[model samples]
Target: MGKENSSVLPVLQWLNRVVSEPHYLLHFLTFFSYFVIRCSATHILAPHLIHHLLQREIQTLLVFAVLALIKGVREETWEAFIADALFLAKICIFVLAFTMDRRLAIWYVLVFLVMHMLTQQPPFQGLGTSSKLTPLQLESLLTEGNTTRLWLVEFCASYSSGCIRSSQQFPELSITYSSKILSFGIVDLGLFPNAAEKFGISLSGCMGQLPTYILFDNATEVARFPELDFETTFFHPTVTKGLLSRHFDLDRSLLEYFNVK
Candidate 1:
């Protein structure tokens, strides 16, 4: 009789009992804390650090917990799905933006999308206007002669011979002289002669090549000038074709430059 009674108890009864238990609350809180920690660590601490951690067993456990939470939410509500999808989409967009050259329209779209997505909430309604400038506004600005064409140049200047020669004994990477050029005219102004000066690199000639060389060197130096010529070209629709073509070539150059191994 006892065995029969246990077997006959409804599944809902077991579920209710499980939910009412104190341990269930403890487990929920623990899982919640872990999720918060992972989210904060990934966004605030170091993205690469969290990226590495996510490749471990702990990340698997966290994913499981997140899945469990989604399941517990019960209803297949639109708001829930939309919220989750947006979160995932925002992450993917930003990741792609950071990984690729910032000059791409796709990168700008990602940034705007993330900003607009966030501003769909209260107290930040004007972000929609601030995050984007309309085509008409850009056109009027261009017609008013408020724009300038600039040239950028970059070159490898010098290297330490000792660092290069000691590849077997005390191997070190050689430092090369790099420069930039910025010209308002069609041709490089050549005003900046010293490659080592603070702004020696010309934006007109070599700014487009900076990322290619930096990637070739396996370095992150180009990130220092995030708002260089790319930002200036952001509002100019006419230059889109040229910019994209140059970017494609730059991608090829990056691979070729890095093949130095």
Candidate 2:
């Protein structure tokens, strides 16, 4: 449950921001006003059409829910299953309300649209954004006082085959593993001699062993991979992801996601 909470921290933060702001309350009021006006106009213009459309929308929502549930079952993860269940429940509630009262259905959909718009440009955009860190930035991160996060630092040369391969994998994995517990970054030895000096690796001498892995926990260096065969370690995303997962006590499900053998 602690791990789950860590993963969901960004979501909780987002909710807090939304509910805490006066602008969001104004947005809600605007949506409510529009929904009331629209529903009133509809009832005055065509009361008979409301019942007819409600049945059709309910039928469509039901069919979509069934298909989505089937797909979620095939996914075979607790998160997916729970998400599908919640989606079905939401649709059922909407359908029931639409059947009983048309005005409530208008309010529901308009409120949902307003919330979706609110979330389009989230405040915590950096939670999932990944970029290379220079020596100065990396040092700042270490001293930022947030000791709970995990940092994966890669020291690699520009021309190394292993570095090239890992570069392609890191961006995708950074997105896949975006959470409170994990971050990914790269340091190019070719670019920064000063940064390489801290790790005791000269830029000119890094050809034979081009890529090195270092893991940090609580702003302290916890693990450093020894110079290993590039083909078996640095070149493979699964091996890297799996090693980090095991070291940090992450879920085994990530192994399957990263295709770790």
Candidate 3:
């Protein structure tokens, strides 16, 4: 019974997530619509009508995919799965067309558009929006202070999915851990693209590895989240407060930071 309940928990959680989030539900409906449309088209509609509908749907998806590509409708040019919304949707339509029913393509495309617009990407703080930082300002702040100082700086872009996801957590950390020597700040690489060069991060649409968090000891670079392979994302861990705390040994660092002062 306990094992069964444990296995069932994930399904319940997924259902909760689906119901609570409109986008998730829309995606669910898109798939659900596919089955309904497929069954109706295959059984009720004439062969000619089904063929005509399938052809139209396929054509529509192709047109939209081309338009979306040219319009630069995606989040980034990396062509990553989730980050590029319309592109991902394009993939979904194609897969549904081929694997499930070609007639389902345009309906899912419409569903994708609705979900995209409804879940309008709110104005993310991006890299610089949270806290403004000029090169000179950053330089001055990094200099060793009178007390043992540590500055936790997050390098992020507003448009970056990873950056946006972790946006609230960083500020929350600032509220929790900020002190004279211990400080928290953000540099929006989106606003200061050149800053990416100095930090070995890229702002290029294809290569922008965002939300790089660096724990600075005075003027020196002490540590960073995702310290390895900041460029290639074979496996980029989701940036969370718990992950941040563990990576930088935050609790120990805080104790040491306070002990010195």
Model 1 local distance difference test score: 0.32
Model 3 over residues 148-247: C-alpha lDDT tens digits? 3787888877666666545667776666676665777788887888888898776544553677888888778988766647453445666666778888
List clash counts for every candidate, in order. Answer: 19, 0, 5
Off by over 4 Å in 3: 1-104, 107-120, 123-131, 144-148, 204-208, 228-233
Which residue runs does candidate 2 get wrong by more than 4 Å?
Answer: 1-129, 202-208, 227-261
lDDT of 1 by residue, 1-261 (tens): 998777556344434543564432333343344445445656564666555555543544466557546743642322233334345434443343334324533544654555454433111011111112232432333244333211121222112111111111100011111111111111111322343233333333233322111111221133222234665434322112134235324334434445642
Candidate 3, run of 10 with poorest lDDT: 74-83
Per-residue accuracy of model 2 over 1-261 as CA lDDT, tens digit each: 999998688467645665775434444454355446446756564566666756765686678778777965564333234334445645654664576468876776776666545532211123234557888887788767773266777677655534543444445456776555567777777788677768755354333445666767666887765444555343433225445455444453344335633
Clashing pairs in 2: none
Q: Give model 2's TM-score versus the native structure.
A: 0.39
Alpha-carbon runs more than 4 Å astray in model 1: 1-14, 57-261
TM-scores for the candidates: 0.19, 0.39, 0.55
Native-referenced Cα lDDT, model 3: 0.65
